[model samples]
Target: MIKWIAAFLGYFLFRFPGAVLGFIVGSFLDNFGGSGNRTRTVFENVTRQSVSPADFELNLLSLCSIIIKADGQVNQRELDYVRQYFLSTYGKEKANAIFRTFNQVIKKREISAERICSFMVQRTRYEVRLQLLHFLFGIAQSDGQVSKAEAQKLKEIARYLRVGQHDFESIMAMFIKSADTAYKILEIEKTATDDEVKKAYRTMAKKYHPDRVVTENEAIRKGAEEKFKEVQKAYETIQKERGLS
Candidate 1:
């Protein structure tokens, strides 16, 4: 019922994540409906939908499922982490509803990580999925340490996401020396004078400037503000390196 509703609504009615939730919940209800057919029902409904393939929601859910099941047990703390993150990053109302729905659906089943990943691969893209991989790594590190299971899951996700081997290695690398954070970011160098810094700032200001961000969504605008700060930090760091105040 939940998966069907979410799938029907999200795919047919265009309700975004609501549909995804519907699918997950519906399957749970169907299998456990005082009978034992929810599994079959969930599988059928999943087979019915096709548009949500690979990139966005599908891959996200798949990766999350793997992470949660990595240690052979999913704890309340991890669940809380995911819930809080969704609430903060997405929205409170949606997060609350999703949590309730998922609890109602998956409280019984313990599906394998491989099953989730199989479904995920069917929906996500092969490239640029490292961003999602990095997100998982960040979440796993939220507790001040990463578990062995988390590390294994990260490697699997990295492979599935097709992140370059070098990029994967550098994901853990730090403090070699950027040499020219400014030049790397702005395509300018140390020899470039104050005027050059000003020019670089100008170009970067245009590139990372908050005003340039589309303001239709206030949330998106805030993200732009963060990006703007990074740009400012890089420019200032460069300027200070050259004693330019």
Candidate 2:
């Protein structure tokens, strides 16, 4: 059955890049079997829409490599975080393949951050773009702190993505724990009344909710879930500090 599906995909997607992508995707589907069915839905949607799965995956890998190398050297911790992410999202075989590809891209350093970001901005939905930014933050913090170089690179990526400063700051607050970070995460001013803070929290909670991401991709939804949790934690921190219930 899987062979038939792969053959069918290969036949239909016989074009150069699509043929190659179809073969890879078909193999992934074969490995996933029942558990991977959801990815097929996402694949179908991508085929019908703007970006192909291969392009999307490659763009992610390219941008991730840029983040990993932003601070002079790539740490094992950052590599491990990326490996774990791909493993949990795409299974072991695909994860290993992606890691290898990522290494090659990094070694070549041929893909520009601007080119990748521009492509993503044109093809990816806003929510997915935000999720990507969130993931970059995770990569930067893999070594326990986001360095100045990494933060600047992230800001550049966010600017290219047209993500609002508030939104970028909100995501940043999640990884950086500072006295003002909680307020930034909630997008509320410190001078706001307790009621105002509560309102901001609710607004941010609703905005960053996992369900609001509107994608069939479970991995993307899971990333949004992390953002959702960050919002909740930020709100709680604010309440505790301000002596509000």
TM-score of 1: 0.45
Each model's Cα RMSD: 9.9, 9.6
lDDT of 1 at 149: 82
Q: lDDT of all predictions, in order shown?
A: 0.51, 0.69
Model 1 spans with C-alpha error above 4 angstroms: 1-49, 52-59, 72-77, 104-115, 118-127, 172-245
How would you encode candidate 1's per-residue C-alpha lDDT over 33-113 as one tens digit per residue? 523322232233343334221122333444565676677766666676557555543357756755654564344355444
What is model 1's C-alpha RMSD?
9.9
Q: Which residue pairs collide, candidate 2?
A: none
- What would the per-residue lDDT of candidate 2 be over residues 7-105, giving only the tens digit for each residue? 344334331222233333444455545242223321233323344445556666777888999998989998887676555445689778767667776
Q: Which ten residues in a row have the lowest lDDT in candidate 2?
A: 13-22
